[model samples]
Target: MADSPGSGAAFPSQSPRTKKYSLTEEKIFYMNCRAAYLTVFKSSLENIISKDQLYLVLQHAGRNPSQKTINKYWTSQTAKLNFDDFCVILRKEKPTSKADLLKSFRQLDVNDDGSILHTDLYKFLTKRGEKMTREEVNAIINLPDVNADGKFDYIKFCKLYMTTNEQCLKTILGKLEVDSKLKCQQFGSHIEGTLERDPSPVPKPSPRVIRKTNQEMFSNKGGSRSPLLSSTRNFKTSVSLTITMSANSNQNPKLTEPNLIEDWQCVQSKGCFFLEEDGKIISHQYRMHIPEKSMVYLTIKPLKLSQVEGKPSPWLSVDTALYILVENESQANLQPLCFTELQNREVFGWTGELGPGIYWLIPSTTGCRLKKERKPVPEEALLVYRDETGKLFLTKEFRSALSDIFEVIDLDGNGLLSLEEYNFFELRASGEKCDEDAWAVCRENFDTKKNELTRQGFMELNMMEASDQGGDPRDLWVILHSMGYNKALELTEACPFVINIHAEKCKPRIKAVCMEACNGQLEKTICKYVLTNGSAKSMDGYENIIIYTYKHDSWITSVIENKLDNKLIIHVNNELSKNCVNNKGLNTYVVEVAPKSTMVCQHVMPLNERQEWIYHFLSSIKWT
Candidate 1:
């Protein structure tokens, strides 16, 4: 596979196990219902039923058992059970012949006991529990009550219990058989209801069902074997009886034929057309109905010439446009328009329906509203493009303005114009010749070997040259003023820089080197200075003056300079020396200052006060 654009390179495919199912609300609700029914069934069967047998019954009724539990049950020996074995347990041992029933009862009389009492009934029911109902219990007792005694002997109990157990098993198993004929008829009624709501113009019997029963059984299409259900004839079931009550009722059908033409009308009304399978009006077409407002895309094609003037006039043809009628109940009286045109010489239209009793003309000139062709907007050229060296490069429209003067100075087509080019323009306005030596210094220091000065380089060179002769660099500053350097630096630092200088108004550190001492201070009396790399360390010495200590970590540094009464106080953070380290070496320095030194240092550290408070609270307070 090709690498995706702008991604640089390709990586190996991810593991297949990464995908997972998202169990939405509807899915969880369905599973909860299935689980409830499964739990009830398992309880009824007790320990005799295997999980697999129960799963089969639930599966037939449309339920998904988790694979993990199914696998665990299948491999477990305690729970493994065959369907036949379960059937035998459900039926119990009962006599099919009356002769055998009498003989079996005789065998149960272990001690020639003549009568069965409460003990025998209790033992039988204690094992069976409520599986057999009260009515069943009465019937079993009455079965062998010989001589109308109203009580069963041991012999009577054995015969009657076996007979009752057989009847119960047969009833439950009979309920489980799947009726194929019923499935087909129900699926058929679903299809017919859709057709009745949205009848097609084409004359053909609508599909009443999906015929899943036939599909499941038949292996070959035209086999010699007769179909279990008749193929050519329609099958009817009790569903028609249910349908008769609501046959003409206003209840809408859940499924309907595809609105091939209905969609075409929506597009046509807005002055558009639709073609292809979406608007195909024909017999034996397959369609399904989705819930209203469900997301679905519809396409449209214009009507054609022959279709417009048909033998009988159809709503859509080659000349007709399509329109859509949307039901927008969310917003009051909202009408949305969608239209498309034909790239070909002529157009075609298909029949469409809007709603009950509303239809469209297949191909008519007056059927659609005509759309006028729009004209293109006019454009004008501005100036020819030029490089930084003032060389023409490309022409552009007048509306296209240069970002800065550096764009005009890039003469060699290099990204950055050379220093010579910058000086040439700087001096051009002044009506003075360019200084060759000064220009060389600016070029060597600022311009990259591409022999180009980037927008930034051009501005810096212009400003430096202008300032060297005591000239204002405002012209250069204006060209690069769009960029807010202070804002950019502030965002990266996460906070604003604060400059504090406490100097006397009379004698401030305002000289070139001394003005630099202002660092970042609020004194307007001192001037602003841009400190480049090497220029910073050159003026580091401050004789008899306290210099703020430098830090090398992410920290909030606060510097305060006091110049009151000829005294200076410096506070360097000496917390680490006082708390963490105490060894004295050459690496560590201790300075002693005289009273007139004009500077003082102090170290402050934090104390664990919470510990002291907790200790006091526990010792002084008493519990009531």
Candidate 2:
């Protein structure tokens, strides 16, 4: 893998990346649609709007505005405005009676608490003045939105009443269903859509890294300079995380496969052969798709002639050479990164970690020369691994897993997953959501029906994913595992993964840690990363689970022991923490632990690279 004697030059320097790509116009339109939300709010919403905050938001959002532009609007640093005040600043006319109505309600808020208790309001409306009925008072309370504390903001209630409760009711109704009738309505998509316009802040699937070939370094196969592979499945030693699917998926009790699931082709993940027969080499170039931030390892395992029954060996006893080809995003430019030969070790090749973007891996004998064979060689098999996963695409096991996923996300029991339904799945993975523009991309690329992703289309999409990631299922596992699917791919009722944070620093925060689990994709991902074969309805059945959080300088370690035998999946969410020190990293974990086994599900060092480590555990996982 060194400058192949054939490579007249050193490996070329990779092109430097300077800026993020611009977003599509459709995503921009989706983002701008958020303005429509303020329209009813033209009647009404997040934090206080300050010039500094607005400038940061717009700049990060890709507007790249000058301080002058923001200054024109913000005017002064001391000037601050709430949502309603900001609306007035926008010059939208306020309803004439709204202010008077709010003032009148404020008179009833004796505590100046900005809200009136439902009971107090009910007394005022029914016990005095215009003398309204209990029913009428209850009806009005439903308009604005009441806090769980049993109070509603009088001003907000007054504004909603003026705008007509219909708008409030529409928003509330949309929250109640998954596939709402509201055209393209999505929470937080508008703001995020603009951020994606820069593509820098957000990470889509990435291209991955590059590793200098193993030759220049120490070889694994002892004296063999770069023996391709030494499988006792060599990767198991290098991989800290191993993703395996249950082979006996059909027997799993909790996973219900769709009765009407459709079939599609399983895209093959491996390419290349070096078999030599009748004094000639039998080989052709193989194409591989590499996704973002992925590591690709090319390994060829030697198979003895007797081990493979009738299979012939590669013509490798003599020297042979192979070239690795890569193409740019548009497939417009084809280039060779490096070449591998049967140098000291006939079977060895190279490993590399690449960047973000779509690229192809081509291993061919076409461009390289092969030494004349003196004698035949043993059979050889080529294996490709992306990160820690190398599971083949479209196996019976994968199909079973994906079919269950389609069923869970379909939401309405419909065979097709709508844009909303699919975005729900997207959100499950990587905590990012997409809109019609993305859905349009899916529809254009895959086979679809009725403008939604059919089961077949969904399966095809995953196949492309498998192809892109070099057969790594880490991304898919993260979504499913977080959803409550144990290692056996069973969705436990509601058992949650636990988090143990060990920190020595006082006031060390764990910020933005959000965890949720249901029959959804995102939760499935958090749990998916760490799981084993275990199935139980809930964590209530397991006594071994323990939760520990660190904020103050004191260290609290609680390692509870379990006595239960039931297998289960669990997601302990950090997002729902009532109040604690500030935090970073919004993460959801679905963990599976088995009876009598003490497994440290996940060990994450803080991005700050301090000594802080977050530990997660899985409930149980089943492997066939």
Number of the top-ranking candidate, with TM-score as the measure: 2
lDDT (Cα, tens digit) per residue for candidate 2, span 1-624:
001111111121122332344656533433333333333222112433577665543432224344555564564443543332232222212223677777888888989988988888888888875577787777877763644468868776665566663464355435433333233222221112111112122221111111234333334322221111111112211111111112221232321222322231112221122222111123222334443354433433121111123433332222223344455654556454544322223333444554444333323222112222222224321222334454554665456657766765554455888886676556555447786787789899998999988999988988788677666666566655434343444332111111111111111111111222111221222232123222222233333443222211111111222344764333322221111111111222233445654333322222211233233222222121
lDDT score at residue 397, model 2, on the 0-100 scale: 49
- The TM-scores of all predictions, comma-separated, are 0.15, 0.20
lDDT measured at residue 253 in model 1 versus the true structure, 0 to 100? 28
Off by over 4 Å in 1: 1-76, 82-101, 107-178, 181-624
How close is each model in CA RMSD to the real structure? Answer: 44.7, 29.5
Where does candidate 2 stray beyond 4 Å?
1-392, 493-624
What is the lDDT of every predicted structure here? 0.27, 0.37
